[model samples]
Target: MSLADLEPNSLHVVLHVRSHPPKANDFHWGLYLHRDFEAGGTKYHLKGADKRWLADHGTTRGVFKSFLLIGLCQVARIPSGLMKDVDAMFRTYDHQLNEMPGLTCRTWVFRVLELLQKPHSGQVLLECNDLTSLEYELLSWGNANALAAADCQQPRPTHRSDLCGL
Candidate 1:
Protein backbone atom coordinates (compact mmCIF):
# COMPACT_ATOMS: atom_id res chain seq x y z
CA MET A 1 0.00 0.00 0.00
CA SER A 2 0.96 3.68 0.39
CA LEU A 3 1.28 6.24 3.16
CA ALA A 4 -2.27 7.35 2.46
CA ASP A 5 -3.41 3.88 3.49
CA LEU A 6 -1.96 4.16 6.99
CA GLU A 7 -3.23 5.86 10.12
CA PRO A 8 -2.84 9.61 10.25
CA ASN A 9 -0.13 11.13 12.48
CA SER A 10 1.29 7.73 13.33
CA LEU A 11 5.00 6.87 13.41
CA HIS A 12 6.48 3.43 13.56
CA VAL A 13 9.98 2.11 14.14
CA VAL A 14 11.22 -0.16 11.34
CA LEU A 15 13.89 -2.78 11.93
CA HIS A 16 15.88 -4.72 9.37
CA VAL A 17 18.01 -7.58 10.56
CA ARG A 18 21.49 -7.95 9.20
CA SER A 19 21.78 -11.13 7.17
CA HIS A 20 25.46 -11.83 7.61
CA PRO A 21 27.32 -13.17 10.58
CA PRO A 22 29.29 -11.20 13.22
CA LYS A 23 26.47 -8.66 13.24
CA ALA A 24 23.50 -10.70 12.22
CA ASN A 25 21.69 -10.15 15.48
CA ASP A 26 22.03 -6.40 15.11
CA PHE A 27 19.50 -4.39 13.11
CA HIS A 28 19.31 -1.30 10.97
CA TRP A 29 16.61 0.99 12.31
CA GLY A 30 14.35 3.41 10.44
CA LEU A 31 11.06 5.28 10.70
CA TYR A 32 7.81 5.04 8.74
CA LEU A 33 5.01 7.59 8.76
CA HIS A 34 1.41 6.97 7.82
CA ARG A 35 -1.07 9.02 5.77
CA ASP A 36 -1.64 12.54 7.01
CA PHE A 37 0.88 11.55 9.63
CA GLU A 38 2.00 14.64 11.50
CA ALA A 39 5.67 13.79 11.91
CA GLY A 40 6.40 12.91 8.30
CA GLY A 41 4.56 11.55 5.30
CA THR A 42 7.25 9.06 4.34
CA LYS A 43 9.98 6.74 5.49
CA TYR A 44 13.09 8.19 7.14
CA HIS A 45 16.07 5.96 7.36
CA LEU A 46 19.77 5.40 6.65
CA LYS A 47 20.41 2.16 4.89
CA GLY A 48 23.69 0.28 4.37
CA ALA A 49 26.94 0.26 6.27
CA ASP A 50 30.28 2.06 6.10
CA LYS A 51 32.66 1.37 3.19
CA ARG A 52 34.83 -1.01 5.14
CA TRP A 53 31.85 -2.89 6.47
CA LEU A 54 30.33 -2.86 3.03
CA ALA A 55 33.47 -4.21 1.49
CA ASP A 56 33.70 -6.95 4.04
CA HIS A 57 30.06 -7.87 3.69
CA GLY A 58 29.99 -7.48 -0.10
CA THR A 59 26.83 -5.40 0.16
CA THR A 60 25.85 -1.81 -0.60
CA ARG A 61 23.34 0.51 1.02
CA GLY A 62 19.74 -0.21 0.13
CA VAL A 63 16.75 -1.80 1.77
CA PHE A 64 15.63 -5.28 0.60
CA LYS A 65 18.67 -5.47 -1.63
CA SER A 66 21.04 -5.42 1.34
CA PHE A 67 18.97 -6.32 4.36
CA LEU A 68 15.53 -7.61 5.30
CA LEU A 69 12.93 -6.04 7.56
CA ILE A 70 12.25 -8.05 10.67
CA GLY A 71 10.00 -5.99 12.89
CA LEU A 72 8.08 -2.72 13.33
CA CYS A 73 5.96 -0.96 15.97
CA GLN A 74 4.09 2.34 16.26
CA VAL A 75 6.06 4.76 18.41
CA ALA A 76 4.76 8.33 18.11
CA ARG A 77 1.89 10.49 16.91
CA ILE A 78 2.02 14.14 15.96
CA PRO A 79 -0.84 16.53 15.33
CA SER A 80 -2.63 16.46 12.02
CA GLY A 81 -1.78 18.94 9.23
CA LEU A 82 1.94 19.04 10.14
CA MET A 83 3.07 16.38 7.70
CA LYS A 84 4.89 18.72 5.37
CA ASP A 85 6.89 20.45 8.08
CA VAL A 86 7.76 17.23 9.84
CA ASP A 87 8.72 15.57 6.59
CA ALA A 88 10.99 18.46 5.68
CA MET A 89 12.49 18.51 9.16
CA PHE A 90 13.36 14.82 8.95
CA ARG A 91 14.82 15.17 5.46
CA THR A 92 17.14 17.96 6.61
CA TYR A 93 17.83 16.25 9.89
CA ASP A 94 18.97 13.11 8.07
CA HIS A 95 21.44 15.06 5.97
CA GLN A 96 22.67 17.39 8.73
CA LEU A 97 23.40 14.52 11.09
CA ASN A 98 25.53 12.58 8.59
CA GLU A 99 26.90 9.14 9.22
CA MET A 100 29.82 9.08 11.64
CA PRO A 101 31.90 6.68 13.59
CA GLY A 102 29.79 4.69 16.07
CA LEU A 103 26.65 6.12 14.48
CA THR A 104 24.33 3.76 12.64
CA CYS A 105 20.73 3.83 11.53
CA ARG A 106 19.86 2.81 15.09
CA THR A 107 21.41 6.03 16.35
CA TRP A 108 19.51 8.05 13.77
CA VAL A 109 16.20 6.50 14.77
CA PHE A 110 16.79 7.13 18.48
CA ARG A 111 17.97 10.69 17.89
CA VAL A 112 14.80 11.53 15.98
CA LEU A 113 12.69 10.01 18.72
CA GLU A 114 14.56 12.01 21.35
CA LEU A 115 14.05 15.20 19.38
CA LEU A 116 10.31 14.61 19.15
CA GLN A 117 10.12 14.22 22.91
CA LYS A 118 12.16 17.22 23.93
CA PRO A 119 10.45 19.85 26.08
CA HIS A 120 8.67 22.49 24.01
CA SER A 121 9.79 20.72 20.91
CA GLY A 122 7.65 22.68 18.49
CA GLN A 123 5.56 20.87 15.88
CA VAL A 124 6.52 17.47 17.20
CA LEU A 125 4.31 15.23 19.29
CA LEU A 126 4.63 11.82 20.87
CA GLU A 127 2.44 8.93 21.94
CA CYS A 128 4.59 8.27 24.99
CA ASN A 129 7.55 9.67 26.91
CA ASP A 130 9.39 6.52 27.91
CA LEU A 131 11.53 5.71 24.89
CA THR A 132 13.40 3.09 26.82
CA SER A 133 10.20 1.18 27.28
CA LEU A 134 9.27 1.66 23.66
CA GLU A 135 12.64 0.31 22.64
CA TYR A 136 12.18 -2.65 24.92
CA GLU A 137 8.81 -3.26 23.38
CA LEU A 138 10.39 -3.34 19.93
CA LEU A 139 12.97 -5.86 21.02
CA SER A 140 10.28 -7.88 22.73
CA TRP A 141 8.18 -7.80 19.60
CA GLY A 142 11.12 -8.86 17.48
CA ASN A 143 11.88 -11.72 19.80
CA ALA A 144 8.26 -12.72 20.08
CA ASN A 145 8.02 -12.70 16.29
CA ALA A 146 10.91 -15.20 16.39
CA LEU A 147 13.37 -12.95 14.56
CA ALA A 148 14.55 -15.91 12.53
CA ALA A 149 16.00 -14.97 9.19
CA ALA A 150 13.85 -17.42 7.33
CA ASP A 151 10.72 -16.53 9.22
CA CYS A 152 10.90 -12.73 9.11
CA GLN A 153 12.09 -12.46 5.55
CA GLN A 154 9.62 -14.77 3.90
CA PRO A 155 5.90 -14.06 3.39
CA ARG A 156 6.39 -10.27 3.39
CA PRO A 157 6.72 -7.55 0.88
CA THR A 158 10.14 -6.46 -0.30
CA HIS A 159 9.26 -2.80 -0.07
CA ARG A 160 9.18 -0.86 3.23
CA SER A 161 5.43 -0.29 3.50
CA ASP A 162 4.27 -3.74 2.52
CA LEU A 163 4.85 -4.95 6.06
CA CYS A 164 3.47 -1.81 7.68
CA GLY A 165 1.12 -4.04 9.63
CA LEU A 166 0.39 -0.95 11.79
Candidate 2:
Protein backbone atom coordinates (compact mmCIF):
# COMPACT_ATOMS: atom_id res chain seq x y z
CA MET A 1 0.00 0.00 0.00
CA SER A 2 1.07 3.54 -0.66
CA LEU A 3 1.93 5.96 2.14
CA ALA A 4 -1.37 7.74 1.48
CA ASP A 5 -3.14 4.63 2.71
CA LEU A 6 -1.60 4.97 6.15
CA GLU A 7 -3.51 6.70 8.91
CA PRO A 8 -2.73 10.32 9.51
CA ASN A 9 -1.54 9.51 13.04
CA SER A 10 0.23 6.31 12.17
CA LEU A 11 3.90 5.82 13.21
CA HIS A 12 6.77 4.08 11.51
CA VAL A 13 9.12 1.74 13.39
CA VAL A 14 12.48 0.96 11.78
CA LEU A 15 14.66 -1.72 13.37
CA HIS A 16 18.31 -2.01 12.31
CA VAL A 17 20.13 -5.23 13.06
CA ARG A 18 23.81 -6.11 12.69
CA SER A 19 25.13 -9.50 11.64
CA HIS A 20 28.88 -9.89 12.06
CA PRO A 21 30.86 -10.37 15.28
CA PRO A 22 32.19 -7.53 17.40
CA LYS A 23 35.84 -6.59 17.51
CA ALA A 24 38.00 -5.85 20.57
CA ASN A 25 36.84 -2.24 20.33
CA ASP A 26 33.31 -1.76 19.03
CA PHE A 27 29.73 -1.35 20.21
CA HIS A 28 26.63 -3.14 18.95
CA TRP A 29 23.46 -1.18 18.21
CA GLY A 30 19.95 -1.23 16.78
CA LEU A 31 17.15 1.22 15.85
CA TYR A 32 13.38 1.44 16.37
CA LEU A 33 10.56 3.97 15.75
CA HIS A 34 7.12 4.85 17.14
CA ARG A 35 4.42 7.47 16.84
CA ASP A 36 4.75 10.92 18.31
CA PHE A 37 2.25 11.55 21.07
CA GLU A 38 0.48 14.62 22.30
CA ALA A 39 0.93 16.02 25.78
CA GLY A 40 -1.47 13.34 27.04
CA GLY A 41 0.93 10.57 25.89
CA THR A 42 0.37 7.31 23.99
CA LYS A 43 0.99 3.57 24.34
CA TYR A 44 2.71 1.04 22.04
CA HIS A 45 1.80 -2.64 21.89
CA LEU A 46 4.38 -5.22 20.91
CA LYS A 47 2.06 -7.94 19.79
CA GLY A 48 3.44 -10.85 17.78
CA ALA A 49 6.98 -9.78 18.48
CA ASP A 50 9.51 -11.82 16.53
CA LYS A 51 13.21 -11.76 15.88
CA ARG A 52 14.95 -12.16 12.55
CA TRP A 53 18.67 -12.64 12.03
CA LEU A 54 20.43 -10.63 9.39
CA ALA A 55 23.16 -11.93 7.16
CA ASP A 56 26.59 -10.30 7.11
CA HIS A 57 26.61 -6.57 6.42
CA GLY A 58 22.89 -5.75 6.55
CA THR A 59 21.86 -2.20 5.84
CA THR A 60 19.50 -0.23 8.10
CA ARG A 61 18.97 2.32 5.34
CA GLY A 62 15.57 0.81 4.64
CA VAL A 63 14.38 2.05 8.01
CA PHE A 64 15.27 5.62 7.08
CA LYS A 65 13.44 5.26 3.78
CA SER A 66 10.36 3.95 5.53
CA PHE A 67 10.34 6.88 7.97
CA LEU A 68 10.62 9.31 5.05
CA LEU A 69 7.79 7.64 3.22
CA ILE A 70 5.58 7.79 6.28
CA GLY A 71 6.54 11.39 6.90
CA LEU A 72 5.78 12.30 3.30
CA CYS A 73 2.37 10.70 3.56
CA GLN A 74 1.64 13.01 6.50
CA VAL A 75 3.56 15.60 8.43
CA ALA A 76 4.31 14.47 11.99
CA ARG A 77 6.91 15.03 14.69
CA ILE A 78 9.16 12.35 16.12
CA PRO A 79 7.85 11.42 19.53
CA SER A 80 10.12 11.60 22.57
CA GLY A 81 9.15 8.11 23.62
CA LEU A 82 10.04 6.80 20.19
CA MET A 83 13.57 8.12 20.59
CA LYS A 84 13.80 6.40 23.97
CA ASP A 85 12.58 3.20 22.38
CA VAL A 86 15.28 3.44 19.76
CA ASP A 87 17.90 3.88 22.46
CA ALA A 88 16.58 0.94 24.44
CA MET A 89 16.54 -1.23 21.33
CA PHE A 90 20.16 -0.35 20.74
CA ARG A 91 21.09 -1.31 24.27
CA THR A 92 19.35 -4.66 24.03
CA TYR A 93 20.94 -5.56 20.71
CA ASP A 94 24.28 -4.32 21.89
CA HIS A 95 24.12 -6.83 24.68
CA GLN A 96 23.18 -9.55 22.23
CA LEU A 97 26.06 -8.67 19.97
CA ASN A 98 28.44 -8.84 22.89
CA GLU A 99 27.46 -12.44 23.44
CA MET A 100 28.06 -13.47 19.82
CA PRO A 101 30.89 -10.95 19.11
CA GLY A 102 30.65 -9.76 15.51
CA LEU A 103 32.89 -6.88 14.40
CA THR A 104 30.61 -5.68 11.63
CA CYS A 105 27.52 -5.85 13.82
CA ARG A 106 29.23 -3.99 16.65
CA THR A 107 30.36 -1.13 14.43
CA TRP A 108 27.21 -0.50 12.42
CA VAL A 109 24.87 0.01 15.38
CA PHE A 110 26.21 3.46 16.21
CA ARG A 111 26.27 4.37 12.55
CA VAL A 112 22.62 3.50 12.15
CA LEU A 113 21.72 5.44 15.27
CA GLU A 114 23.63 8.45 14.00
CA LEU A 115 21.78 8.29 10.69
CA LEU A 116 18.43 8.05 12.39
CA GLN A 117 19.15 10.96 14.69
CA LYS A 118 20.71 13.19 12.02
CA PRO A 119 20.53 11.79 8.53
CA HIS A 120 22.12 14.57 6.50
CA SER A 121 24.75 15.56 9.06
CA GLY A 122 25.65 12.07 10.20
CA GLN A 123 29.40 11.55 10.00
CA VAL A 124 29.14 7.89 9.10
CA LEU A 125 29.07 7.30 5.37
CA LEU A 126 26.43 4.90 4.06
CA GLU A 127 28.89 3.59 1.49
CA CYS A 128 30.19 0.94 3.92
CA ASN A 129 28.91 -2.61 3.64
CA ASP A 130 26.55 -2.09 6.55
CA LEU A 131 24.37 0.34 4.54
CA THR A 132 23.42 0.86 0.89
CA SER A 133 24.59 4.12 -0.68
CA LEU A 134 21.50 4.35 -2.86
CA GLU A 135 19.01 4.03 0.00
CA TYR A 136 21.02 6.38 2.20
CA GLU A 137 21.20 9.01 -0.53
CA LEU A 138 17.47 8.72 -1.20
CA LEU A 139 16.49 9.18 2.43
CA SER A 140 19.02 11.93 3.07
CA TRP A 141 18.02 13.79 -0.07
CA GLY A 142 14.33 13.45 0.67
CA ASN A 143 14.69 14.83 4.18
CA ALA A 144 16.93 17.67 3.04
CA ASN A 145 14.58 18.62 0.23
CA ALA A 146 11.57 18.60 2.50
CA LEU A 147 13.33 20.71 5.13
CA ALA A 148 14.55 23.20 2.54
CA ALA A 149 11.08 23.58 1.10
CA ALA A 150 9.58 24.09 4.52
CA ASP A 151 12.20 26.68 5.42
CA CYS A 152 11.43 28.59 2.23
CA GLN A 153 7.76 28.76 3.20
CA GLN A 154 8.48 30.21 6.62
CA PRO A 155 8.43 33.97 7.21
CA ARG A 156 11.77 35.70 7.75
CA PRO A 157 12.32 38.51 10.23
CA THR A 158 12.30 41.89 8.47
CA HIS A 159 12.60 44.23 11.49
CA ARG A 160 16.01 45.91 11.66
CA SER A 161 17.82 47.22 14.69
CA ASP A 162 18.50 50.96 15.40
CA LEU A 163 14.91 51.79 14.40
CA CYS A 164 14.84 54.39 17.22
CA GLY A 165 17.37 56.57 15.30
CA LEU A 166 20.32 56.04 17.60
TM-score against native, each model:
0.64, 0.22
lDDT of 1 by residue, 102-131 (tens): 666776677777766654345436545666
How well does candidate 2 match the true structure in TM-score terms?
A: 0.22
Candidate 2 C-alpha lDDT tens digits along 112-132: 434444333332212223234
Q: Which candidate gets the maximum TM-score versus the true structure? A: 1
| Consecutive 10-residue window with the lowest summed lDDT within model 2 | 157-166
Runs off by more than 4 Å, candidate 2: 1-77, 105-107, 110-130, 134-166
RMSD of each: 7.3, 18.4
Q: Judged by lDDT against the true structure, how good is candidate 2?
A: 0.29
Query: Candidate 2 at residue 82, lDDT?
Result: 50
Model 2, position 3, has a per-residue lDDT of 27
> What is the lDDT of every predicted structure here?
0.53, 0.29
Q: Which stretches of candidate 1 lie over 4 Å from their true place?
A: 1-5, 20-25, 36-41, 51-67, 99-101, 119-124, 146-149, 152-166
